[model samples]
Target: MAETNATILIPDISGFTEFMTTTELSHSSRAIHMLIDAMLNAIGEEYEVSEIEGDAVLLIKKGPAPSKKEILGICLKIFNAFHSQRMWMQQYTICPCGACKAIINLTLKFIVHYGPLVELKVGRFVKQSGMEMIVAHRLLKNSIDSHEYLLMSEKLLKQVNDSTETADMVWGNAFEEYASIGKVGYHFALLNEARKNVPAPQAPQSYYRKDSTPYLQTTIAANFLDVYMVIMNIPGRAEWMPGLQKVEQDMPDICIGSLHHCLFENHQSTISPLLMISSDEEINYAESCRIEEMNISLVYEFVFKKVDEKSCHFSVRFMNAAELPIPEETRGILLENMQRMAEKLKLFCEK
Candidate 1:
């Protein structure tokens, strides 16, 4: 056994237990792997990956502890990358698999600690065994009381003496007990709260229609074609539209008379007749879906306009076929959903 001083960090996907139990095993497993890959990518060169424990990753750095600046940056990079991947998955993933679509429900959390570790090689795997490793893993179960948060052991904090940069970014708990590391003290940081503390990227500019009609328009800072590709992919609405499990077009080539159908999660369905309004000229399309049972139809319009050299204005317009008046509250909900979809799409391409 080789003894070494090391810092252990476990960034786990919280709530994965309930997620795996409820979602289809195949899809859930694939989504978990993808998310795991994303987290590993976020870690990059600074930390070493010792092992993966289900939804949690075991990262160890064999040396002196990282400064507050290093730890803070690493945590934020993981946090930001987690959401960035989720946002991209939510916006453009066309899998239609239940678990793939439900990724937005999962959140990432971290447990960081520093101590002496004994390294033992078990075949091809390098296992870390020591009191600190036990303490780091035990720190995973805590009274942090928040789903999206990072917990750091007092041991690690003591190693990073100068953290004037991140001094205001954390709060502490004086003591907690562990079987191996008794009376352990630590600090917890809500990742969302950390985001507010850090300087964030600028959000897109939005302008919703002031009229009672439900519509949302936003200028996203990306090439118009990047945004247009996402809007025009009809079969890919599985990403942005909730409750839609799968979409299929009967004809191989979508012409003026192509028929398409959408199967929703609630067992309700919609059959739409595609209109070849502007297939390739510019990103604009209109289609109508019928809810036969309700004796009503929804008209969906997608339009994209170039705003400038770097940005474009994209809008989603929905209206009832019978020209029925929409309830104020219902309109608000629709507008909110549309805006969220736009924002997700923006994040997907912009990032």
Candidate 2:
């Protein structure tokens, strides 16, 4: 027999009504469809979408009660996906009205609970009505008024963890809230682990210049620039060269893409290529071509020349593409994530 498990329902919209009043109905409808598709794709195959309410979508994912870590991971993935879509949309001439507003528009609310209910199938009509479902709907509505990204029963939160830290990465303030839902009381905290994970931005050791034009400096130590370039073109290699112009043009997008990939993509092992070439003969032009074809852009290259028994001089160059500009908020998020990556790399390299 299938054990009764808790369900996680997320109802969200792009706040189209507020910002998309000028848009044609057909275009707005298509945009909602795309949003739904993106949500379904991100949540995996297990969850069943219950309904669509205007621009909002309701999704139900059935599973044995998820751990707090698992719940946090799922929420992070959803937020990251929404953030990416918002950024992509901003690139277009037509703004999705106020759809891109992270403060008031681009937010999602989730309601989760355990229930002893079953879906009723009546010919072509499907029924998923239950006390739990009703509660989920009510909570979603409450979330809108509360201005909170997530709301759950104290019972659910306690089942997930005794206590969790809530670090405000965006606002730089940690907050804790307690909730009483039904007969349960639970405490909730924001997750600010990302701040601890990111390394502080460091000064580059050397700056690259092309025809008297100087670009940002590069560092041997793992920094945002290194991680941004490496993961964007992961499972590939980078070199210092004058011909790589497109890579530079797409640097901002590439950085954003890498951030999206890291936060969303689930993989068992690291995807970066090993830099093991000790001699010039080991570097093959054909292999470089194959790597580049993988869509991995090498934005910077480090030429390591041995200086002594334990030190070396590193020469670095930025790739030659047009520079892409990101919004202040997006840049802030990237910087936070970059610091986290740097800390992790520091730990790994030490070992």
Highest-scoring model, TM-score: 1
lDDT of 2 by residue, 276-336 (tens): 2233111101001112222322233334343333333334332432234334574454345
Q: How high is the lDDT of residue 128 in model 2?
A: 70
lDDT score at residue 49, model 1, on the 0-100 scale: 91
TM-score of the candidate numbered 2? Answer: 0.43
Per-candidate TM vs. native?
0.57, 0.43
Weakest lDDT window of 10 consecutive positions for candidate 2: 281-290
**Model 2 RMSD vs true structure:** 18.8
Off by over 4 Å in 2: 1-4, 14-23, 93-104, 143-148, 162-351
Local distance difference test, candidate 2: 0.41
| Model 1 TM-score, all chains together | 0.57
lDDT of 1: 0.71
Candidate RMSDs in order: 16.1, 18.8
For candidate 1, write residues 1-351 as lDDT tens digits.
Answer: 999999898888988998898887977887788778878898998899998889888999989998877887898888787777666555444333457567979988888899899989989988999888888888777877788887888789888875677766666575577664677788886777764443343332221222344457777887665676565565776776666678888854332334567776654445443332332224565566575545556666767677765787777777766667656675576567567677787786577
Q: What local lDDT score does residue 132 receive in model 1, on the 0 to 100 scale?
A: 82
